[model samples]
Structures are given as C-alpha cells and as structure tokens.
Target: MRIELQNTFVELRGEQNPVASAVLDALRSNGATVGAVAPVPDILIVSLPLLPVAGYDPATQLQSAMATGEAMFARGSGRVLFLVSAAAGMPMRRHAEFSVAMAGVLATVRTMAMQLGPKVLVNALGVGAIGEKVVAGDAAMLGHASVKRPGTVAEVADTALFFCDPLNSYTTGQMLSVDGGWSAGYGRNF
Candidate 1:
C-alpha cells in the first residue's frame, strides 16, 4: 500500500531524527512506497518531537501534523499514525501542561478519525525512556521503569509497523505505550 510520511519540524532536507529515519527506511525497505507531498496515499506517519523551545511550539506542531493527516484522509488516505516521544511520558517540562497538551491532541485526532469515517484511523505511539539522555534523566527522577532497561529502536520500529499494517484494522484512537510499564507504576497506592 502507498504511504505519505510527514516529518514535521524537519529542518534539514533529507536529514531526520534517528527514529523517524528508521521508520521511513523500514517502511520503504519493506516495499511500501513513500511520498512526501502527495496525491495522498493509504497511510500517513507523523513523527514529531515534544519539547519546549522559545519559538517552536508543540501545539502548533501538533495542529500542523493533524491538518496534514486530515488532508491526506480527505484525499483517501486510510490511516494516520502519530509517533510522539516525550521525556518520561511528560510532553512538556511540567506534568499538568503535558497532560493538557496531550489530551488536546488526542481528542482532536480521535474526533477527526470519527468524522472521517471507517476509512481513516488515527493512532499514537507514546514512547518513554527510550535510551535518550533526557528521557533517562527523567526516568531516574520518576524512579526506574518496571522494565529497568531502556527500550530499543527495534522495539519501537516493530510497534510502528504493527500499527501501519493492514492487520491492525480493529485499533484506532489508541495510545500504545512502549513505555516499559512506566505508566502503570506511577502514583501506585501502596
């Protein structure tokens, strides 16, 4: 099936972050045709980073990604997989801010998926403590993840592939956390 891969916040032409690059490469090498600005396709994979920068805004970034995905869906794209990585499940520096921002994005995606009908599916991959130094530091502050070891690139890539595949028809508006059981242990009442 054809795919439209959107790399939001891509500054360097043809250069991308490791995870994004890996996902694109894996999809292409596995025989999926990749298009940038397209006649649209069967899927759109959005890989955007979550961080606080002076002029770079996460909300706008998310909106742009969502808009592009919506446009693709309007043009007959089947699914959109939003791949977002936050430092230890925190979208921003503050927990509450992160929660609000994440919720907004999720709600928008879910609503769009519903409005667009069964042809369009929206999914998110929430990664936690994936060996990045910033994530590692955050994980330490939150105590160790239940898995202890950081997740690998292969692991994340595999999950992305699963969502991108046709076999994943039943899942949508879902946040599949590759967070190593981190979300479960948070604020556990002992």
Candidate 2:
C-alpha cells in the first residue's frame, strides 16, 4: 500500500528527529509502500512539523492543508491520519499562526470524515513533543503536560500506524490527543 506523507522535511532533514525515524520504521514494519499523493490508492499521512519560528503565515498554510486534503480525498483511498501537535486546540505563545493553521487542518479532517464516511476514515493524532530536536525551532508546551517530558517517537508512530491500519473500519472525524495529558488540563503538583 502506498502512503503519502504531507510534511516530511523535518523528518528527512534532522538526524535527531526520532519521530520521523519511527514513522519510517513503522511503515517499513507494516510493509507499506510509501509515495506521493498521485491519482493512486494511497494511505494519506499528514504530519505537521513545528511551524517556522519566524514568518509564519496562517492563510498559506491553511490553503496548502486544504488543497492537500482535497487532493488526497479525490485521488487516494479514503484514509487520512493527521499526526500533528496539540497546538491545534491548545495555543502557545508566539504561535498564533501555527495554532490557526492546525485548527484548519483539524476542521478539514472533521468535514472530510463526515462527507466521506463509511468510505473514508479520517482521524487525527495530536502529539506534543517527540524530542528536543523535533521542537527545536518551535515553542514547545510539554512542560505543562502531566508527563512533563517529551513523548517517545514510537508512541506517536504506533498511533499513526493504528489509524492507518486497513482493518480500522469504524472510526472517522475524531481527534485523538496523544500529548501525555497535556490537553487534559493544567499539570500541577501540590
């Protein structure tokens, strides 16, 4: 099966990006043939890395995300897993653009799930931090998480792979927060 990954530059560029490595490893383990989103039956994996610290553009990012979603929905089989940051729902300092853009992505996932359901299973896996390397250029909110530490790449990849599983026939339009309780509430120790 072909897997079309939207954002893979960080994964491809960083030696310290364990999430990327784990994603690739998971795909390999599952024997998935990964490729671009052409007019082919491929599993679409949308990964949103840390947005650029400077020059963040919400409109452009949103459009790109929508276009990609439309393309995948039109061309590939009805399966999309958004492996993104918790920023989609939880905002952080100086990350307004990222937050907005991710919200758009989540909206697309939900709308597509509703429109294409029974035929497509669209879901999101929200991650906080994979490693310092992964969030080097972006503002990280893992300190507020109950775990108070970066999540392992394996944790995230496994979730992504689960959503991509061919037998996952019943889920759609859901956001799975895999952020170590970051989205649960404020982490406090008394």
Candidate 3:
C-alpha cells in the first residue's frame, strides 16, 4: 500500500512550514511536480498550522481553505488534503480558538467532500503533538494517549502522500488521524 503520485502536479499552500517541505520532498520523490497554484492542480495541499500561531483566526483560515478548494475544483478532477491538528479534538480550556479551527477543518473536509464528490476527492490529516510540548493541550493530552510521545513531521507528510494517492479511490471526506492513538483514548486520564 505504498503511495504513488507519479506525474501528479501538487500545489502547496503553507508559509515556511517544515511539514509542507517534507510533503513536497516526498511528492517529488514519487514523481510529482511542486509548483505555483494553477487553475486546477492535480492535488491541492493546505498545510494548516499544527500549533496555534500568534494571529491565527479559525474562521478566516477555514474560509480561505474552502475558497482554495473551490477554486482548485474548477476543472472537476483533483484531490484536496488539509494538514490539520488532531489535538483540536482534545479541548483545553485555554485554547478555544485553536480547537475551533481544528474542528472547523474537520467539518469542512466532510462538507466539501459531499459537495464536490464523484470526481474531486477531499481529505485531511490530523496532526498531533509533533514535537516538544508547545501548548497546554499537548501536555495534557499526551498523558492520556497510549503513545506518550510526539509524532514526526515526516509522518504527517507520509499521510499526506496517502491521501493524495490516486489509487485511494473509495476514501473521501475523511480525516486519517496520525496522532499516535491519541484520539482512540485521548481524554482517558482527564
């Protein structure tokens, strides 16, 4: 079940993101071309911030992602993969904004899949504590997760490859959680 994106054209939207870099590398390795956004790219990869940024706005970000998807779907056949955080499911009283954004990303993925089906495939990869504890939620959630460690950025990139694979014909409107079993039992200790 290896990912094969040969000759696929990918348009990546992320600002100095290492995960995006990793994804691009993997895609290029698999014979994909990373370039500017075309009218309709073979694959549209949006790398949403895994941790809360200084001025992150959930509504605005989600709106932009949807707009991007709509524009990319103009030609009918394409794949949209949003790289978001799985920790969004683990609500921390201190990070309402981020939680909302993450939840919105998931919902948007589903809704878009429904609206743009039969040709365009929409999916997401929910990232989880990929590095040192950056926020209060990460520390709290990791305690309950069976895998008491953070995931690697490469893991997220690999999942992106999976979602972008043209062979994955049956799966759409789904978020494959790469958070190391955290979602399976995230709030167990809480």
Better of 1 and 3 by TM-score: 3
lDDT of 3 by residue, 67-183 (tens): 766775676688888887774555444566777767877888899899878678889887766756442126565665578887777777788778877777888998888777788
Residue 44 in candidate 3, Cα distance off native in Å: 0.7
- Which lDDT tens digits does candidate 2 get at residues 84-142? 66767666556766777667768877987887656667788777755656552232456
TM-score of each predicted structure versus truth: 0.73, 0.73, 0.85
Backbone-clash count (model 3): 0
Q: Model 1 TM-score? A: 0.73
Q: Show model 2 residue runs off by greater than 4 Å.
A: 1-18, 51-76, 132-140, 187-190
lDDT sort, best first: 3, 2, 1
Residue-level error in angstroms, candidate 1, position 186: 2.9
- Which of 1 and 3 is the better model by lDDT? 3
lDDT of 3 at 171: 89
Q: Residue 148 of model 3: what lDDT?
A: 81
